[model samples]
Target: MLLETTPDTSAFMIAGYTVAFVVMGLYVASLFIRNRNLDRDAEMLKTLFEAESSPSSKKEAGKSAKKPAPKKKSVSKKK
Candidate 1:
């Protein structure tokens, strides 16, 4: 009697590889987007820090650094 053999699994293998590559590409794209956003945030923070550290801001900060002395309150005798 003649016996039937199993079919090839190359199609399944190709499909699995396709899925894996797609997932990897998506992950890489997300990483790139995140990096770009972080770069933009860093630039904004740097500019803000520079602005705050400028001479005018420093002068203002110095002027506001001194606090007015607190006055002592007089207490009255209570019954």
Candidate 2:
């Protein structure tokens, strides 16, 4: 009868787990940073859009309320 012994893989298992945890942590941190940047961009775009549209619309309304200029009459003299 021959007896067989299994090889110990605890170091490899620990290394694998550590690599997985570090990769997962880095991925999560990247996601958080991207989300924060997107939120900031959204807020900036909203403010810029509001500022541009509101003032332009008000100016258009003011222009529309005014009357157009009248045309001048031309006179011709024949001798």
Candidate 3:
């Protein structure tokens, strides 16, 4: 009589591969979403910073444009 070999279990290997692919897909998607959100935040912050700084700079420029009064010369001799 010839001896026959039984096939080994492969379901566990299939399940592990499936889980690994699913997790990697989810991680890539999450990274994409996070990068998009960060880009949006950066744009918003840049606009906000420019909006805040421009007015202050303009006001400072206007104030500095005014002629200042001349100071009188004072001589002090220290012995």
Candidate 4:
């Protein structure tokens, strides 16, 4: 009777699973970091927007907008 035995591949399987989990963990961690950064940026932008929309800033913007352009001096042509 000739019987073939199955080869042991458990070690390779474990290694592959470990590598996959590690990569997944790193990806999830990076996503968390990016989400936190985006939230922080959103808050910062909101504050800046509020500051720009304030009455004091509006008055300053209005003053600048109401200014007239300076007259340009023309050069006299010599014949």
Candidate 5:
């Protein structure tokens, strides 16, 4: 009669699970950071749009418009 022995793979299985969980955790953290950045950008854009579309800003821009500069006299070169 012959007896069969089973091989142990518990350590490899544990290592694989640990790596998978760590990768998933990092992915979740990155997504949260991206969402926060998007929120900040959206707020900044809203503020910019509000500034550009306000009546007072338009009036101020029109009032402070720069005048055209005078033309300079050109000197002719002899050929």
Candidate 6:
């Protein structure tokens, strides 16, 4: 009886490698997007905190020395 030779499986191996590279590329891209979003959030929160603190502190400091305006007295002459 003659023996049959098996076909090479290199094509299947190459396809698997391609799929692995594509998946890794996608994962790296997602990580980059998440890092950018976190940086933006941090910058926004810092700005918000500065905006919230400055005006209130100034108003509080002014409150200690500020006086209310004097009211004018009404004069009634017989008309």
Best by lDDT: 4
**lDDT by residue (tens digit), candidate 6, 1-79:** 2576777899999999999999999999999777766666665565555555556757766544432322222322212
Q: TM per model? A: 0.57, 0.59, 0.58, 0.59, 0.58, 0.58
Residue-pair clashes per prediction, in order, are: 0, 0, 0, 0, 0, 0
Residues 1-79 of candidate 2: C-alpha lDDT, one tens digit per residue: 2576777899999999999999999999999777766766665566555555556757666444332321222221211
Candidate 2 vs. true structure, TM-score: 0.59
lDDT of 3 at 43: 58
For 1-79, candidate 1 gives per-residue lDDT tens digits of: 2676777999999999999999999999999777766766665565555555555646666444422222222222221
Query: What C-alpha lDDT do the candidate models reach, one value each?
Result: 0.61, 0.62, 0.61, 0.63, 0.60, 0.62
Give model 6's TM-score versus the native structure. Answer: 0.58
Output the worst ten-in-a-row residue range by lDDT, candidate 6. 69-78
> What local lDDT does model 1 show for residue 31?
90
The CA lDDT at 67 in model 3 is 22
Write the number of the candidate with greater TM-score, choosing between 3 and 5: 5
How far residue 13's Cα lies from its native spot in candidate 4, in Å, is 1.1
What CA root-mean-square deviation does each model show from the true structure? 17.8, 21.3, 19.0, 17.1, 17.3, 20.9
lDDT of 5 by residue, 1-79 (tens): 2576666888999999999999999999999777766766665565555554555656666433422221222221211
Model 4 poorest 10 in a row by lDDT: 70-79
Q: Kindly list the per-residue Cα lDDT of model 3 for residues 27-75, writing each as its tens digit.
A: 9999977776676666556655555555675766644443232222222
Clashing pairs in 3: none
Better of 2 and 4 by lDDT: 4
